[model samples]
Target: MKITEGYMPYLNYQTYYRIVGDITKPALVLLHGGPGSTHNYFELLDSLASDDYCIVMYDQLGCGNSYVEGHPELWTPETWVNELIALRKHLNLTKVHLLGQSWGGMLALDYILHYSPTGIESLILSSTLSSASLWASEQHRMIRFMSEVDQRAIEIAERTGNYESEDYIIANTHFMHAHCAGVYEIGKAPDCLTRPKKTGKEAYLYGWGPNEYTPTGSLAGFEVTD
Candidate 1:
């Protein structure tokens, strides 16, 4: 399969994207989680790129291979929605299917609500929370499930508001690996995490928190249920 790459100029910066498989086929756009996450996490999506669909993946502004020079305010869902619209127009895609995971699903919802683009054929939301409150509730549950020692560490970190501490991060990663994907060993890991250029870290720091159930970043108060 041939892969083509390019940049789509947006208001604040350019979004980098790649197209795989046949462009003549129906388009399937993959939206990664992390309001700041790159398309790298969705490399497993390549499996769907064969003859049935044209796979489109891109690093949203401020992430991955995309331009990172911009104001933090530009990270809002409104800006990302515009980026998606620009990319769709640049590709000249008449209609396309969308698959979004976690924060990516929120972006998709924003796009559908604001633009209501005729080009949107379908939407797939995976492992996503409908609102920030729901996410916070889930985090509490996850923290409760942790071992007593780990739970105490998290409680201390939260009390001190030291979310960036190594202890917090370590506990958070363990929780994610156990509950998020249910994979114990690294060797048996999923393809997305095994990709050479994974965007999990950058996205987590900027958009999500150190854990799947926690929201410690700018998106902490973000709610999509409305």
Candidate 2:
């Protein structure tokens, strides 16, 4: 097994990436979630390397080691989509599998729909939704089941724009653990679990809003309406 790490230029920026396992074998590109998240959380997929597949993981520009400025304007899905294309080409991967989690999964779908890209052996889209409004709707359904106190707190926070309040964070964490797919026991969260909290906030807050339920951001109105 060989591990190679480097940066590839993309649209005036450098996208950082890592390749695990044998480059000659079938490859899997891993994309992390968040318009501003990193690839570190996907490290658990290193286990797939032992099975004879190349595992490629990268931090999109403005996140992790990509080193570009984390401007909200650069957080568009198209930018990340193009970055993935540049990464695949720079790595010289002709035929490969792709697995993207959450926002990464969304990127994967966008790439596929845009090009119906050939040489992609398969794709694994994990914990992602095809529609943003639908996501908000689903969020409503999910939150409806929480305790009445939490429900009222979330509503107050959203209405007051007080998302940082202790009541809001506590209620948000409760909702997140049940829905965010990566949270854990408070004292036992590994770096992967805590990383997105450290990455691009403007991107997350501006793109997806304060939380899953309140998508008052750029992506708030997005959906596959077509």
Candidate 3:
């Protein structure tokens, strides 16, 4: 059970990465969600090292340990794809397995389709989307089933594009609890979910918009269903 962590150069910045388990073992590279989320959320996955795979996790360009500020241009999927390619080459991951969750899943899809690089052994997509528009629609549909107060709060926020309102935050919290972390009781999520440090808020807003159910950013038109 060996663990190592460090930074790798990406573009003009540094990307922080952590490795758990035997380095000689085949790499099980993880892709975390959030065009802005951190790899810290994958902390529990380190136990897989005992199962004989070297677990690799990293903070993408603008999130967590690898955070950078004021570069909204880097929030696009293309930048992340390129960063992943660089990471693979840097780590000499000749044989790799990918487990992508949510936005991370989308990044994996983009990496494979956009680059079609070799040496990828397997892909696991979890709770992800191939169509941003479809995801948004589904979220809205889910919202329709909530209490009228929740529904109206969300509706008013969406209509006014004012997500900062207290009512909207309350509504959004309800939606998150029901859909995002329904498995855990309120304020009782694991450290992964409750860890300190801000997720790349600027990037999240620029790449995926202000909330989970909306899409008014660069990824608003993103789709790979075809």
Candidate 4:
């Protein structure tokens, strides 16, 4: 399998992208989550690359190799949607299959609905939501199953807007282990999850608020459901 990588110019920023397998084959584009998460985590799917279709992954505007700062305003879904369009145009990806996870799933839905771009062969959404309110409600429901100590930590953190407290951090870690990524301990997770030297924390904060259970940012009431 051949691997190629480069930066695609999008507006004033350059999006770093990687392609595995033959570029001439149909494209299977992978979209990550966090609205700020990097594509590194999707490296696990690179094995899907073959002669049928190439695997395409890229870090969005403000994370990983495409890291940019001092632009919280650009953390909106529209910003990322336009960047996706730019990537497809830059790569001349006429036919594609999209696989989006979590926030990435939300982005994929937004793109398909807004532009209805042609040549979308298939779409696969994993662990995503169409309504922000529903997402928050579900998170709260999940939190209810946690220990009272963890619950108190989260409640206090939410009330004080102090997600940096030790208790809050511990509680959040517990939640992540139970729901997000619990297969391995802190440092034992795959390299893709830990290798990024920088992350789009600002973007995450601006777009998603303080933590997973809270919805205070631009996505506060975001809904695309009918």
Misplaced by over 4 Å in model 4 are: 183-194
TM-score of 2: 0.86
Question: Candidate 4 has what TM-score?
Answer: 0.93
lDDT of 3: 0.89
- Give one clash count per candidate, in the order shown: 0, 0, 0, 0
Question: What's the TM-score of each model vs. the native?
Answer: 0.83, 0.86, 0.93, 0.93
Candidate 2 CA-lDDT value: 0.79
The 10 consecutive residues of candidate 4 with the worst lDDT sum are 189-198
Ranking by TM-score: 4, 3, 2, 1
Measured with C-alpha atoms, the lDDT of residue 106 in candidate 1 is 80
Model 3 CA deviation exceeding 4 Å by range: 50-52, 183-190
How does residue 209 of candidate 1 score in lDDT? 62
Instruction: Give the root-mean-square deviation of each candidate in angstroms.
Output: 2.9, 2.7, 1.9, 1.8
lDDT, model 1: 0.75
